[model samples]
Target: MPKRTATMLGCAVLLGMLMGESRAQTDDPSGSPGAGRATVWIEPSVSVGATLSSNGNASSSNGRSELMLDVTPALRAVLNTARVKGFVDYSLRAEYFLDGNSGNRLSNRLNASATVEAWDQRAFVDVSGSISDQSVSAFGPQNLTGLADVNRSETSSFRVSPYIRGTLGGLVDYQVRYALQTLNTDTSIRSDSTSQVLSARLGSRPVGQQLGWFFDASAQENDYVIGRDTRSDIARAGVIVSVSPQLNVTLSAGVETNDTITLQRESYNITGLGFDWRPSLQTSLSVSVEKRYFGTGYNASLEHRTGRTIWRYSASRSASDSPTQAGSVRLGTNYEIVDALFAQSIPDPILRAQAVLQFLANFNIPADAQNFQDFLSSSATLNQTQRLSVALNGIRGVITFNVSRGTTSRLDSLTTLGDDFDSNTEIDQQSWGVSYGHRLTPLTSFNAAYIDQKSSGSSGISSKRQSVSLGLSTRLAPRTSGSVQLQFGRFNNTAGSYNDAAISGRITHRF
Candidate 1:
């Protein structure tokens, strides 16, 4: 189907279904902050400052005296209704040369997310995207290390997913989902690509059942606009057995086939074992192990919550072609999860009652929003990823800590063409960070953080970096706020070392 037609058809179906259902408003905003009195809102801010570097531009062989002006203007908007939610965060930064004009430039960035519920809650649509200027990778661990170049790059990416799920005549449960994601870079357009996945599943009603049966099928296509294209098909049937109230085990078998860009088409049998355990309200563990054509792999996550603390951990190993986009396809015959865990949205019992039922109904939460924050640790690579994090909340202060580690042996075929990629791409990376936010008063706050990062590239050059930041923010008026921050970053390389320090501030007004 043509892209335009498919989108229109999906929108039409969603609208038609919503037209037939009664309108209702959900009470909670799901922790999303927004304006309460208006459907449309915008907040804008401006900042100007200076950055001093002992060795500017990260050049080690020779030192140069350079100081740059940082001028930034930013805006945020939120739109909320009974059945829809949307937001946009945007900023523009223009650097001026205090000593010279040769290296001054302007940068812009925007991030947005939106969701529309239709069909009386039976169908829904989700859209999200980001265009940002960053001197580091999107992945958390990789971001900790300083980039070889301090100049920020402009990267843009987006995803559109629509889904409909419910039961027919209250007997047969069914779900249909489709998604498309694409990413592009100003530095490497050849890495850009569009990925699409479509899927459907059917199962018997899951209410009050110890054992349930299900069947799932899906198809995925990855078209690298500048590199290669690939497609996949999957189909599977499985049974989930609830051995006890707190524990459940699932056993299943399926088939998967992949037609890759440079590799031969391959088909393989897939077998898997999955377990879900909820020892109590504060704890949950989920583990899945599967046998793949190349090897055996597993993905596991554990979460625990105490009065003032929440902890999360996840580990996964997957062997597949490098992925262009980061998201999940419907589960069918394939047992390998790829980067699905990072892209999915896990379900939360506190958010919706029926959400938990959806899990038992189909025995799979394909797009769970509650998945561990894997995106912070895992990149769009073929590798093993592991992450652990903890957040603590107190009466006057909050603290968050996380660690991420990952390793990969090869770069994606799309990245092989550029000499820069060959020179800077990493084979191993490990990073950790800790942040603290304290409320000095009801309307004012103080924040501080420290980050340490290290990485080694395939080219054999190793580097370590460390950074620390402190800031204070307070309300200036009824609809206004202001902040000032100071930061220091140091980079140590095999050949030499460099350091940077900066002071910046901003004031924002909301309306």
Candidate 2:
């Protein structure tokens, strides 16, 4: 049996044993007086789900399916009469891909904690330890290949960490932690690696009402075999001050350094500040500004809520000396119109429906300075999108519908030095979809969805796509559930037509 399956079975057996012991104690006519003092409790659960997708485009006409199983079991011991307590939690997970080309992955994690109270429960010493392992397969395009080609790689990693926390008086607390991680890879070749990290933080709350401050920092180092070695280090110092119950401010600065075996080392410094205000019970706002060696930006937003209505809006702008700059603004709102109309209805099927529209404008690209300059000088463009969504609920199921339209303007210039450059471009796109989900029983459900999309570009490029999917899920046992899904999609691209279909299933149990 697989490791995950074995672990689930072991947990089931343990739960059975515990139940039996509890029953025996309850049935004893002359139970031992001390028996009542023994405290034992366990909680376990598991879940498994899977999805499959297939595309029609020849270049992407492949099908893929995934199955995952997860289990978690925890136990806790609390001695209210004593000053000590402890708890332990463990989790196991595994995933499998139906596509013959895909590899399976697995993970296991464990956490243990203990705490001791002192000073009339105002202060305490807490300790915690954890261990985890993760393994996964990799396959995809590589820079070394020149063109996209098949290549496979697998990596397994493990981590161990421990930490301690304590409080001084009633106003201050601190914590420190350290962790070590190791990684191993097996493929046509083999490699090994290790890393270490250390972190610490301290915080305090003055005797006054609603004021606090904190500072944190960390550093890490990595060593590798069969590859260039690298090291990264960072230190941060910051503070938070609450001016009043409704206003606050925060500021921080940090330095970062990076070095590689065969590459030149680099270092930089960063600083930032932010402020928040809740002037009233229903309104909140925040803003921040920052600048780096080559770039600077600022952002701000405000939100308000009353009864069943909520409104929100935000805008931001950024620029860099690399001769690149861009800015955008957005506004939207959501309201529970139906709930207000049917306040007396026991279960309104039309829970809510919302319509939203947004516009985006882009100018200049720092990374592609040449292309951005040519396009901007030849064509000034504007883009906008509008969306609408509706949701309905019933005793057994829920349904949702969504639609969106998008458009972009013309481009006028092709060359950096072209005099005729009057930037202008025109493009349009539309998409719509509907989805439904039903709960057949306490442990079973069904879901389905359909979507259609079309797009046209100013360069005479046009395409359309359609997709449909359905799935069913049910519980096989108290702790185990199984699911199956089917999906199909077709696309008519500017180059050609494509279609694909796929079906997949999975089973999972929890402890």
Q: Best candidate per TM-score, number?
A: 1
lDDT of the candidates, in the order given: 0.59, 0.45
Tens digit per residue, CA lDDT, model 2, 1-511: 1322333343334333434444443323557565443333334545454544342112344423323232333332222224444433445656554544334555454443444453465454343333332111111111110111122233333343446677878677787766555444444233355556677888885456455677777676655443444555666666777788788887877775655312555776868788899999668898876553223445677666554344444544332111011111001111122232223332321121111100000000001001000111111223344555554555666555556665544221222322111211455667777666677776677877777777666556666767777878776775566677676776576566656665656664544
User: Per-residue CA lDDT of candidate 1, range 335-408, in tens?
Assistant: 11211221124332122222322221121111121112222111234567888877665777766676878765
Quote the lDDT for 83 in model 1: 74
lDDT of 1 at 501: 65
How high is each candidate's TM-score? 0.74, 0.44
Worst 10 residues of 2 by lDDT: 357-366
Per-model tally of clashing residue pairs: 7, 20
